[model samples]
Target: MRRPLIGIALVAVMGIVVWQWPGSDAVASAGAPRAAIASQPVANHGNWLATPTADGKLTMVAGGQLVIDAELRRLFDFLLTDSAEKPIRQIKDNARKVLAERLAPGAANVAYTLFERYIAYRDALGNVKPAADATPARLADVVGRRNALRRQFFSEEEANGLFGEEERYDRFTLDRMAIEADVSKSAADKRAALEALENALPPALRQARREPVTHLVEADKAAELRAKGASDEDLFRWRSQEFGAAAASRLGELDREQAAWEARLDRFAAERNRIQADASLSAERKQQAILALQNSQFTTQEQLRLDAALALRARQ
Candidate 1:
């Protein structure tokens, strides 16, 4: 197929705390000592609930009723932070306390068991590595092992709640990678593979994957046109045909911004050349003049671009 060397980022399933921006109601209720935890209207998709807390934050509710507590939140934060520095046993002990306080008598035991299994899954992933010339089968084997581990640790329903769509994502990625690596396959075959892979995905993820692929293909086409010295009009027409009016309009805006930036750079270069050629000025004075000119002409972002351009010119 001679497919492009596209980097596909594999999805990792981990238990992490999600933070959402505070809503108006949450903000208004903040600082109230005993604010009621309101159930936010979430889609009836699974055993999950969006419960708003008194501190203008939202926490996950498991089994659609059991509100996850501050201890669990603290544990999640600790696990995520690179600087946590606590030993594994200590971390587990702390998480146990949090889960114990939050969950019902029997439910707490199950939650703690699940927590331990989650940590084991993470550790297993860290230790797994395939060979340098690993085949599609090898990749599939790794994915299958991970899934098996999940199944061993948690029930099907529980697994789905903790790692939504992750298993499907792994399968999709593995299939795509295999297709990309098959040199004997035709472009049409590869396209078919891509279509099948995308079709298998849930709607939301399918759209997310498709948009980036579309953008990459369009960018490559644009680069080819640029190399062939196509006119701006020609580029606009091409983009419009490929991606539609909205994308073409956005590209036009970007082109105008770029042209303005280049014009300013040209002006700066001319002024800098003039300063350099002024024999009356000392070297230190010339440097100071250039600095002053740069400060006057460019905003922070523009200054960064100007500095990069100057560095590239110096290198050449």
Candidate 2:
């Protein structure tokens, strides 16, 4: 199976050959030439992973310093997925070309150099084996070894920019594990310790870490309110109190979108059923009418999930 890296979804690009899951079959083609990989239209080589343009844009900081951050690593991961089957030289070449096209000449040069080190760092990670006993100390040891490898490969500035957020999260996880393992601490003490650990994180990292859990808790509250016939204003007030006005507005927009989608699905389902039940219409005619209705109602992208939506509705 093709494993998605770091929650990044792989979109199937038209005209590019879909990646075959690496297995015993891939070994048979291990010695295949670089040209064997499908050529993309823009990059001209490798399966190009799409990056979210806002966050993943590559640019330099003021004073000509390279902006060595997680986004750069994201870009590297984007290209590296394409390089999964290619030789090192070809992989570097493809990545270099894409970087040159995306970034300024000077930034591209710096990025290519970092890309080389990143590849080496990833190759080195294959040597990091998990310990037999899954203890907090053992996990911390593994993390330390990885950090050491990163420091060896990258400058302090580069390491900080590239892995700072991740390192902070790791420390938080390890400390939490240690607290959980401490038998002397009462439940309240452990909770206080974990709260302190979260509080110690950088503001942005703390919010990023906490938002999903907060969202789930708020979602349950919102559902309860809606069950009691709460108005949009009421929901917005609650959301604003929980996540601020801007987030509340976005959440309201999302709620409207979901409502609109459910309404459309209902319309489509009713029309489809009517067509199916028409005694005068043949099965072929019913299918054609349903297809036309679908085309008229939903965009190409929305149509992709129509079956699943209908199936889910059926279950509900």
Candidate 3:
């Protein structure tokens, strides 16, 4: 043990000394090929287990010096890097393996289902062919444009069409440079808009403009609902899809229904209020008759969601 410790100390000292030398990078490169790994992390060698399974798969945003822009990566360089045949092959093979795994232990029915769908899609395409485009790229050999290339290999597009689409490559080619150009234009526009908005804000509301308004909007709505005698529980119920959701989701149908209801309610309430104010319907009579029937119990959250949806629809 003492000898081993002494040897380790000597090795560490030598390693530091050599690493500090002028030609160390070249030496490290030369040695990289010769080094033997004593162990491998789960992420090594393109293993399926290496990739993490996120709770809900989403297109996550990545940026900075480390991240290459997706539009450029996918639509430009990656599309033309000696063709995508290898990665395509990888996707095909891996997809088949994934299907087999999913259908393991007599899961023939599911496997058949996936395969049938895949084949049917291919059949519908008629004359297109498959390429081995699914294989992942190897980077360490490449030079300065490496990171840009690296970004392409692990791009959103590749991830999107991960499962084998046998006929995809035969029909379409990715135009990465054009895509990158668009991305650059979009980013520039966004930055310009933000800057313009900030300049217009007279230095007072700049911070407020940049911050999230979802919760603030929610609070304002709840307060309004409270003013209308709506209990918190009523709001919660409406938010939890306890109201108006069971109706059909066809926007035209919903619009017509909502319009009719709103028009009827507005006219009815206005007439009722006018009658009540005329001293014809006493407060006691109004309470016992019309007012008692029109109790609107709803959550502020629900109202906020509706307002937001309506705003979006109007914008559209």
Candidate 4:
């Protein structure tokens, strides 16, 4: 079975930082050292250090240098790099050391706990195996399991710090997925489900979700119409209504190009037939003529498509 389209939802949840969490101070303290308000900018390497606020909040210095320690930078590099070949155990160990060195006395443990949960969450997500007949309930169950793990591992404050806006977005996605997977529901019911989900999201995220949903729905409708032998003009109108004038115009150009290509293919087919039927041409001459015709008709990229189309036609 194909993997469910839950990756986007997962990314949305994991990528965001919960700035409003009550325990934000604990996490923030792990960041760069606070600079004094009037501290002179020090040029370290290529970066400039900024003066801290009166309350000791880290601020950018005049130069490009960040106030963060070298160890913190190294830690970030290790985490961000493609470590697919490296052992997970080694990475975790390195991460612990980095956090211990960089974070404040009490903050390091909280940060480390978040890191551990994140890694475990990812591993569990990878292992989820949906049933052959994937239903709304089955898919929801998978999401539920993930949520359960999250709840089990992190407190409300920790979740807020780690997930932030992503938490709501993920719930929104699961609700949307459940609606889509419910084959028992009518089209109207699915539409209602989706609308309700959108309405429930935060204003910014509501708009974000709406655009993709609209694009996908319209694109699917266009494909359906095309399969039913809709004209290019009809498709242009549909696309315009769905995606606005700019996208519609772009698609119209693609349609005209495709029509021109098909016409060229027809001409090539006629010429090839004439060459094949020529009684005066020797077998070697006929082969040479066909090769010459192919070279004249298509460039390398076009030739691949031309070959595939011809092969498909032959099969038909």
Best by TM-score: 2
What C-alpha lDDT does candidate 3 achieve relative to the native structure? 0.32
| Runs of candidate 3 exceeding 4 Å displacement | 1-249, 292-316
- Give the Å error, residue 104, model 1: 17
Tens-digit lDDT string for candidate 3 (110-211) = 333333343333333322222112111111112112223323433444323331121121111112212233545687775665455446533322322222
Candidate 2 backbone collisions, by pair: none
Ranking by TM-score: 2, 1, 4, 3
Worst 10 residues of 3 by lDDT: 1-10
lDDT pick, better of 1 and 2: 2
Backbone clashes in each candidate structure, one number apiece?
A: 0, 0, 20, 8
Q: Give a tens-digit lDDT track for model 4, residues 1-316.
A: 0111111121111212221211111122223222111101111111011112111122223442323322222233345344577787887787778666655645566555556766665556545443223343553464455556656666665555344444465456556766777889999999998888778766655544443245457657878998999998899888878666776776677668877988888898899999999999999999999999999989988988887887776798
C-alpha lDDT of all candidate models, in order: 0.55, 0.66, 0.32, 0.52
User: What are the per-residue Cα lDDT tens digits for candidate 2 across 7-56?
Assistant: 22222211111122211011122222211111111111111111123224
1-316 per-residue lDDT for model 1 (tens digits): 1111232222212211111111100112222222111111111111111122222112335653433332332244344344247787887787678666655656667666666776666556544443223355655665566567667766777665554344555566667778877999999999998888778767755544454256567768888998999888999999888767766877767678877877888899999999999999999999999999999999877787777887776798
Better of 1 and 3 by TM-score: 1
| Residue 93 lDDT (model 4) | 80
Query: Candidate 4 local accuracy as lDDT?
Result: 0.52
Error of 1 at 248 (Å): 5.7
lDDT of 1: 0.55
- What would the TM-score be for candidate 3 when compared with the true structure? 0.19
Q: Give, for candidate 2, the lowest lDDT window spanning 10 residues.
A: 38-47
